[model samples]
Target: MSLTSNIADGRKKKRRRMKSDSDISRPSPMQSHIDACVSFKDKQVAARVTSDAKMDEWFVVKVINFDEKTKKFEVLDEEAGDDEEGGVQKTYKLSASCIIPFPERNDPSGTQEFPAGRNVLAVYPETTALYKATVISTPRKRKSDSHVCKLTSNLLCAYLRGYLLEFDDDEEDGALPQRTVPFHKVVPLPEWHRQRDLCIKMRLNSEFGVLNM
Candidate 1:
């Protein structure tokens, strides 16, 4: 994806902490966290921007300056702009709503269980960019560590305790690819968006006369 152009503009990778798998479990970096980050300054965050392709996507950005007076934040994108722009790292002026603070590690037990099949936004491995994905598995136990069980075989046992995520855009000749992402790298979609998506799906089901018992 061509990830530049303004929603006020810029991009990269970042990670933070937070977990809610009960009733509040929905989308990532909850809106409340984003709202409380009003004093955003010198912090790494994920900012949803509108790119040249006209698609909204999340990117990791650093807040270089905050105009408290105007309630606007000036974020610096680590991505050097296009050649015509002299390949300089670009910055963006964005509203608070467009900026999502990284999750905070507030869970004392550190046992947040993300349910399987939940939609989320996870960092694409080896890159800072956040993209839509789904939870394939959330740290389950193996019936047997025998080589027959992929989840229990090899060093993957402890590793499976992290998360098995399937990227939405991952497609290889009609095959879907899954990756093992650390728990910290996965986040729920914002609650609003999650509910919205749910409502849309319900509507489609209703329209097709698909009833759920």
Candidate 2:
């Protein structure tokens, strides 16, 4: 899918009466009790989608459509020729748990430039799969002349400069070495995880009487 097609201006389109899928619509009671959270229609975030292969590989997808009533999402694979045979981008209907949302870039917790040692999901080199990576360096500005998008030459010159990342699974001596991934291909963790983590930390602090200090 084209970038423009994937990113809309937040104007609501005509609502489609989505039907609830029995399997994905409701989370198990135990799962709900483990972590109760709220869902938002306004969550503007990209998603990491498991490929058709289900081989632990994924591609970054925008234009996320979540149906709270059904607890499911309709995500578009923005990668060109991502369809089965290589023609156009493909769409997938998946359960809520299947979609992993990226944190908003405007979150007050951090800026687009993630600090060194920050954990992130980044696209592996020459592949659509995303992997956990540790930021070794902040992004640097770089120039580009690629005409992939419909932008002026001057405007296109400022494509993102990928930061240095050491993938988590690369602990072995001959694993994929540290590499760079453009800003567009990297993203922070979802808000739900961040909230849960903070809550856990606070609970631990309270148990230790650290909060009373």
Candidate with top TM-score is 1
Question: RMSD, model 2, all Cα superposed?
Answer: 17.0
The clash numbers for all candidates, in the given order, read 8, 0
lDDT of each: 0.68, 0.60
lDDT of 2 by residue, 23-92 (tens): 4777888567333323423343345455453354556665455555666677677667835657787777
lDDT (10s digit) by residue, model 1, range 103-158:
43333144345688888777788877888788888755323345534634444453
TM-score of each: 0.59, 0.44
How far does residue 5 in candidate 1 sit from its true spot (Å)? 72
Clashing pairs in 2: none
Model 1 C-alpha lDDT versus the unseen true structure: 0.68
Query: Distance from true position, residue 142, model 2, in Å?
Result: 9.7
